[model samples]
Target: MRTLDHAACARAIFESIGGGENLVSAAHCATRLRLVVADAPKVDQKRLESLPGVMGVFCAGGQLQIILGTGTVNRVYEEFIKLSGLPGAPAAQKCTAPVLPLPQRLVKTLGDVFVPILPAIVAAGLLTGILDALGRALPAVAAADWFSFLKMVSGTAFVSLPVLVALSSARVFGGNLFLGGVVGLCMVHPTLLNAWSVGTAENVPVWHLLCFNVKQVGYQGHVIPVIIAVWLMSRLERWFRSRVPAALDLFVTPLCTVLITTFVTFTILGPCFSFAENCMIGLARQLSTVGHGIGALVMGALYPVTVVCGLHHMYNVIEAGLLSAGSLNIWMPIASAANFAQCGACLAVAFKTRDPKNKTVAIPSALSAALGITEPAIFGVNLRYVRPFVCAMVGGAVGAWFGTVTGIGATAYGVTGLPGFLIVGGYILPYAELLALSGGVAFAATWLFWQDVPAQDKTPG
Candidate 1:
């Protein structure tokens, strides 16, 4: 069968889905294209799935995802973003939809909170890794004054994590910044810590001062509990205002929510957060027992299909699980390499294609994929080229095997793209050399495997 015109195929997709006007909002998660439409009745899912550059179409989390190859997805996403004006300018918008549902909304909110601060997190992780490396390479550096300064710089983010989470959550929840900051301060308040520490001491306090154990530690950089606290606070504040006379409403609401929510945060929410953290950590430990080979194979094989379902973010919980445990695990490294492999496959197609537009889409996808961003690569390249995607998966399996055998694991929690190295530094020893070798091998395998595929057999959208 003759291949479809790539750009025309995208336009047809837009038109068939009731055009850009039907779009209420759009976003992309780790893999799938998420879109919310004004009228689902007009969407032709079967037709969209058949379109050139489309891999599949389905609904999840109340959004429609048009799965494209890693090669062309980004271009199509960009085109769609321009057609629908989102937060970033037409040219700059990367994701396609907005947050939906309670859990998804919370995830989106946390993502927004963390994304802006990711650079700082990465820098801190890198510095910490470098310090660890320096300690290993030049033991004397640890004794030097500069090393202390480096430690301070790297540790500041984590130590004051609640402050950051509060600031970001305030913006997301549209609450009082000062109150949120105050709440954040309470989480890390020295008095609270001391009281908790002393209470939990082996010599228990003569009388349990409070019904709840004060010794539980607060998660400094966490979002879930704090956001939930603030959301409940907002509701309480509103309720308080309704009951109080108009003259005292403003003062009463703030005072009430702050006091009530603060108590809840410390006594209930704080413990809940710690429990969730432990649960995630426990899950990671369970996954670790499976051995890296089986773990990577299962994760890598399901990676593409997960992308199709927009459930890839669910895998990120595994990374977070590893982070809470203060160790590295098997998921991110393998998944990241697989994504880059998709990029390499896309690049091959871009080079082989005679069409200027397809070439245009493929090149950027190649770059984005290499840098650790794969939306562009997947949507732009691999999804369009079926054989290339399959080859990319093969490459992913190979990379996963390498990671499993070598015990490659991410050291930190960050996006898995090229920047993943800094994250790798968080848990693994000899991070720098290991990262270079692992990343290089994955890239090489992807290029070598997909570069020879015949362009004529590439799949139509």
Candidate 2:
């Protein structure tokens, strides 16, 4: 293999997208160079794909993603930023790509808000799982001082999750992160009843000011309400900044923003949105159990479709709600089933395809999918072939039904596929069974139904 020319690759990408003037922002995540261009039509995508080190190119979530693989993409991103003269990690800006539908935009926003905080959640989740497993395997260890220390460290992220969400949402919505954090802290303050314990607390405290009664409740393990509150805060801060005098703006804007936002949030936004969020979570739990797991089955099958449309991140809100309410994240199992099923379908394609390129791409993409990143398999092999995608969907549906019926759940969120075993706690056997069932179904279906298409007959769109 030839050494990848990072600078040359960056230059090629910059030039192909019509140089710095056409680019609005440039960023990279694990594998792809995510770019927001001034005009979508001006992007010479073919030239980009043909560039050395460029593996694939596509548009999703209102941005053009150049699949440059791991390590390589970040290096190229650094060089690309230099050449384009763009700042690293700027505030979220509007993508000028062909206008996406409202749902797509909203999904993109949620993804932006949540993606930054996933590492924290994943770290905490994995640690929480490990601690739970240790406690179960060695009950006495749960009483150990070191074990207690580890537990506290692991619990901080989940307990302060609203703060994390608020900070990220503020950035995405273009607000001060610190102020946003303050809003988050206010919602989860010690004066209120912990949202998780609201059901069991015998005497729920209420605050009576002038005319109305407000429940002193903390918003823990919640996503939507925190997001709404921060978004309101961001808008208000910006509004106040424009009107407030520069001499007083520094103190006045933040004070007013926090005071007004928290006051309304506590009085109205918290109650109404938290209720709505709860209803949504309740509906999700009901669906997971309804009609003997029919809802889980359908959701599992359709989950990948939402992923393809960039709407799957919305599930993060639901999962966060479930976890916050002291319920297990049952949604993770369904997601894992769906993701692993795709891996199975892709692997089948790898073994069956005679085309050298198809075989090469399918094998690694399948492995990536198995490890919990399915974009490579879904876009590069399964969806491209069409048949395998459907097969995987069928597999996902069956596996999700089994997982739901068996009551498989994870201790946390943001993990799936094989690594899901870590966070599954006592559900290890059932989770493994779910993966096997889903993967087996998908593999068998794809092997029996899908035929290799000639390279010239198909191309990624």
Best by lDDT: 2
Provide TM-scores for the models: 0.70, 0.92
TM-score: model 2 vs. ground truth? 0.92
lDDT of 2 by residue, 226-341 (tens): 99999999999999999999999998999999999998888888888888998999999988889999999999899899988878988989998887777799899889999999
Q: What 10-residue stretch in candidate 1 is worst by lDDT?
A: 88-97
Clashes of 2: 0
Cα lDDT of model 1 by residue, 1-461, tens digit: 35545567657777878886777666554445567777889898767755665644656556666656444556666666666565422211223324345665545555655655556655766677677777877889899999999899986765665666666667656677777887877777764433225445665323133786555354543445666676666677667876899998777778888999888887787668767866765665455336656666555545765664445554544554454334554576667667766766776767766765567667766776766666656654666555666666666665665566666666455656566665554345433333344345444544565443344454443
